[model samples]
Target: MPARKIKLSTSSKVFYVICYTVVALMAIICLIPFILLISGSFTSEQFIRFHGYSLLPGEFSTEAYKIIFKTPQRIIRAYGVSIMITVIGTFLGLLLTSMTAYVISRKDFKYRNWFSFFFYFTTLFNGGMVSTYIFYIQYLNLKDSYLALILPMMFNVFYLLIMRTFVSSIPHALIEAAKIDGAGEWRIFFTIILPLLKSGLATIGLFLALGYWNDWYNAMLYLNTETKYPLQYMLYAIQQQTQALASIASQAGIQVQNLPSSSLKLAMAVVATGPIVIVYPFVQKYFVAGITIGSVKG
Candidate 1:
């Protein structure tokens, strides 16, 4: 009555071992850089200047982190701005993307194909950077606005298409049954479709969150106020200032000891990346499922 265990042939065992070895090696290779990054961030600036980065820290120090945290108020403000932008953008993006995808994926929608094409065409061609800047600044007057950061990344064409594919995979009969129960479009979407699209929502939401969190380009272009800078831009500004200080010191024949330039870069990365790394594990199952399902159909 017990299930029989399958026996592997010698060649099969060898093949299994090879596959496992290759995968393990690839995973370790990917992990090595991150390990070095963390190690280098804690390493003393003098040691790093004398010898390049290594897997382990040589003469451990927190000077890089100390330099970064010197302006604690600014760092906290930047963290707040980044967090607020990421949360709001991700929520709005997922809602808008899911709605658009659901509408387009409906079989009975009269102009679905034409609307899809219209969206797809924009991806192929766009107004150049000069025109876009003019429009955002001159026309929209979104200069120095948080919307500048959120709006550009909120509704990606590719994410919409992926959501559409997920929606299309749902059986039409389920939707029809909901309609038969006299449920309105809004009701059906909220009560039926939204619950069923958990994996898809999590996948797109994470992408939107990452985009908003990492965005510094739109901030540089649109924002003039130092108070409005996000975490990434704040780190970038600090790096620039450090480099400038080093340059001026060199020109004046004065050596700037303990500049922390190389180590500061690694420290900034650790700060920016720590939150996402913590959050990813929670949604990883949904992310993998959504990717698999979305890819199957399209």
Candidate 2:
């Protein structure tokens, strides 16, 4: 067969140009703030006061990073907590979700629909924050613990739904063939079904990992110990304290003199985000590829 020729009309070419232009402009709007934050982190304290936020620092210095790096222990501990939670939570959550999805995707299972419904109902309604907080603290007695951070968010209904949809698309003939070969349900799931669902698994796994990495709400509500704070909550407390002191020092009615408060805040933002900024590309490549392939037929 001869290859078909392709052509674009002038109007279509104009539309493509317009879309590319709009996308580029929007990207710049979003990217400028991040650039300013990074560049501002290196700005001198005196220069920051005069020039405010900018992509190009009026005067460059590393004093803020010096202060932050000097107190290495706090930053290190926060990173440890973040990594621990992110790793453990993402693995367990992915395992449970995939297993549950495998079970629910079975049409022959009489109660599969009911089970799926039971899971779906959770998204439409959830225990309010106050009740959920009290339940975790007073009933579950998980306050000031790592479990407080991990347990509440371990499994998400949304992820389960996505996984179930993906699993449902696997050919039923595959399962019937496995049964004909005398494979058990567990064996079929582990040996055959799971290997086929790698794209969906990768996408959902990344979602769960990012969720655990960025979570500070659970710690804010339940954790009391300074030692247990995740990276985000630690950053929050540091920013709050820094701002408060800067305010009080200004109350003396003198030119507020302090270490690089603005610059330090920006530096902390960079440090706190270091892991995700580094890890996102690898995981998200799998995620984008996964979403594209998964959506094609199912």
Candidate 3:
């Protein structure tokens, strides 16, 4: 079969050109900084000191990476910690959030509105950081604990609302039919409701992963020992050490041997950002579809 072509008016043609132009420009705008970051990471420290950063390296060197990996054990351990927490947190958080949202989404469930309000209210008002910190430290005794890093991020109120809205849009008749089949609530939820929430699950899962991967605040507050530090916090500690070395060298009127200050910063940024950026492509299709469908009704 021949495809029918719909002709566009002159105005529509011009609009298409404008839209494409805007999108192309935006893509370049997002890409240029990353290009500079990669190039800067490879640049020699001395060259960067005199020439500043360039899109291409003034003189290429791997000393920055060498310095970062000089103590390979530390960096590798941090990487492991970060990866472990991110995986565990994302999986558990998604399960809890989806289950909670599913219950609230059901029309026949008594007191769903009250429970929804209870969850939603937390988003608007929360105890201040000081009190929460005290509670976690004193009551929970979570100091110097990995749970400190994971628990804070386990469930986000906003993500819960998104999940609830998406699940609510599923047909009532479908759920009724599931019940008529002698399927219990747990069975209906696990087998039927979950299968249909793929897009929403992908969207929420991505959000949870990013949150866990990039988390440094909780690590900073709760983690006292070096081995417990995640990658971001470890990188931060390295940056601080570099800065301290620079300061000491200046004070002693001596040259700091292999001060990777500039390149180290750029390299750290790349290392920290690289993995998570790779994740977006896998979820990109589900992300757009999920947000659009979930937000359509609510």
How many clashes does each candidate structure show, in the order listed?
0, 0, 0
Q: Tell me the deviation in Å of residue 9 in model 1.
A: 7.5
Model 2 accuracy (lDDT, Cα):
0.83
Measured on C-alpha atoms, candidate 1 has an lDDT of 0.84
lDDT of each: 0.84, 0.83, 0.84
* Number of the top-ranking candidate, with TM-score as the measure: 2
The better candidate by TM-score, 2 or 3, is 2
Q: Per-residue lDDT tens digits of candidate 3, residues 1-298?
A: 2332367788878998999999999999999999999999999999999999999998999877776665466667888999999999999999999999999888888988898889878978999899999999999999999999999999987788788877877998998998899999999999999999887888898878888888899998898997899999977776778664465345444467757678878887788788867877887876776566556544
Candidate with the larger lDDT of 1 and 2 = 1
- TM-score-based ranking: 2, 3, 1
Where is model 3 more than 4 Å wrong at Cα? 1-25, 243-256, 290-297
- lDDT for residue 180 in candidate 3, whole number 0-100: 93
Lowest summed lDDT window (length 10), candidate 1: 244-253
lDDT of 2 by residue, 1-298 (tens): 2332267788878888999999999999987987888899999988889878789877989977887776567779999999999889888888898999888888888998898789878878989898888888898999898998887788877777678778988999999999999999899999999999987788888888888989999989988998889999988887888554354335433344666788988888889987677887777787675566546542
**Where does model 1 exceed 4 Å of error?**
1-22, 243-259, 293-297
Model 3 reaches what TM-score against the true structure?
0.84
Q: Candidate 2 clashing pairs?
A: none
List pairs with backbone clashes in candidate 3: none
